[model samples]
Target chain A: LAKTTQPISMDSYEGQEVNITCSHNNIATNDYITWYQQFPSQGPRFIIQGYKTKVTNEVASLFIPADRKSSTLSLPRVSLSDTAVYYCLVGAFHSGGYQKVTFGIGTKLQVIP
Target chain B: SAVISQKPSRDICQRGTSLTIQCQVDSQVTMMFWYRQQPGQSLTLIATANQGSEATYESGFVIDKFPISRPNLTFSTLTVSNMSPEDSSIYLCSATGLAGQETQYFGPGTRLLVL
Candidate 1:
């Protein structure tokens, strides 16, 4: 399992774009960067994931540079309801027989209206 | 995607007592995971529940304190033994994706307040 680092907290106004970056300098070659959003009292939900370059979804976009040492999750036009803790995880693209994946202390994004 | 549900959404238990949190998935899953989220802390993986076998626990977690049971592919339970004030936190259950992907869907979580 790869360890990840992220901001402890961040604040963003409504209708603004928020980008949360995660650093995993020791990321493995076959590892993929995945992001999850967790609201209060709820489980973390998959936001976006990508190995490199950019990957966009209905909810968010993931950007990974060539180095793959870090990745960012971009949420567009944020709202108060979007206030949640976002987790960044580094793990193998494919687990051979289900490896134990860990989640780090994610960035608590507070979308202020 | 799978729909996961848990029992006793919130419970207040006395010290030295135990509480069993149940996790149920709509569809059969290959693996189910249990996690603990301490106050103002990140999530920690407790163990991986495999049907018909013992669960593999993490470094700090053990089967004695946090016993797990995977009766089948769609159901599992985690029991918090000898509850204490430190045990007051949210317990979540999740299921891994069908393929080897790291995607996991989580349950509503069981909030345990040890008094």
Candidate 2:
């Protein structure tokens, strides 16, 4: 498993774009970058995932540079509802073998209305 | 994506008591996982439940303390045995779409408070 480092907290205003970046210096070639959003009392929800470059979804976008050591989750036009903890995980996309994805201390995003 | 339902959405239990959280998936899944999330902390994998087999627990978790059962591919349960204040946390269950699928869909989570 690859360890990820991200900011403990971030503040953003409504309608603004929020970008949370995570550093995984030991990311493996077979590893994939994934992001999840968790709100109070609810389970974490998958936001976006990408192996390299940029991948956009209905909820968010993921940006991974060529280095593959870091990935950024970009939430566009944030709202108060988007104020939640965002987690970045690095692991194999295939779970058949003997690999497990572990989540680290996530970035807490507070969207100010 | 699969829909997962966890019973006992939230509960308050006395210390030394035990609670079993149930997870049911709409469709049959290949792998089921249980995780614990302490207050103000991140999620930690507790164990992986495989049908007709024993669960594989994490480093800090034990089968004696957090026993898990997988009766089939669509359902699983996690029991927090001999609960303590330290056992107060949100327990979440997740399931993989396929055998090789890494994308996990999580349940709403069960909040357990041991007093």
Candidate 3:
């Protein structure tokens, strides 16, 4: 399992783009960077995932550099409902076996009005 | 993504009591896990519910306290034994390995409040 570090908290205004970065300097060859969003009183929801370069979904986008040591989750047009804690995880998932996922403190993004 | 559901959405139990949480998935999944989230904190994985075998617990968690049962591919149960005030937290169930999807899908958590 790879350890990940992220900013403790960030603030963004409504309708602005929010980019939350996570660092995993020891990321392995098979590791994939994934992001999740958790609102109050709810379970964490998957946002986006990427191994390298960029991967976009209906909800968010993930950007990974060539080194694969870090990844960023970009949420476009933030709203108050998007204010939540975001978690970045690195693991070798869907390998036909059990993969252990570790969750960091996460970046609490507060979408201000 | 799989649609997961948990029983007893919220409960308030007395000290020394026990609470069992049941997790059901709409589709068969290859992996299921139990996690704990204290108030205003991140999630901590308690164990992996392995079908047809005993669950694999993480460090700082024990089967004696957090016993888990995965009888099949789509259903599992977790029991929080001998609860205390400190044991109050949200228990979440998650699953993965559904078809071509690689990310895990989570269920609405069971909120346990030990008094």
Top TM-score prediction, candidate number: 3
Model 2 chain A scores worst on lDDT over the 10 consecutive residues at: A92-101
lDDT per residue as tens, model 3, A4-82: 9999999999999999999999999988888999999899998888899999988998999999999989999999999
Model 2 reaches an interface RMSD of: 2.4
lDDT per residue as tens, model 1, B51-110: 999998989998999999999889999999999999999999998754545478889899
Measured by TM-score, how close is model 3 to the native structure? Answer: 0.96
**How far out, in Å, is residue B97 in model 1?**
2.5
lDDT of 3 at B71: 94
The alpha-carbon RMSD over the true interface for every model, in angstroms, is 2.3, 2.4, 1.6
Candidate 1: list runs displaced more than 4 Å: A93-99, B98-102
Where is the poorest 10-residue window by lDDT in model 2 chain B? B96-105
TM (chain A), candidate 3: 0.95
Q: Which should have the higher lDDT, number 1 or number 3? A: 3
Regions of model 3 farther than 4 Å from truth:
none
What TM-score would every model get versus the actual structure?
0.94, 0.95, 0.96
How well is each residue in B6-112 modelled by candidate 2, as lDDT tens digits? Answer: 99999999999999999999887888999999988999999999899999988989999999999998999999999999999999999886445557889999999
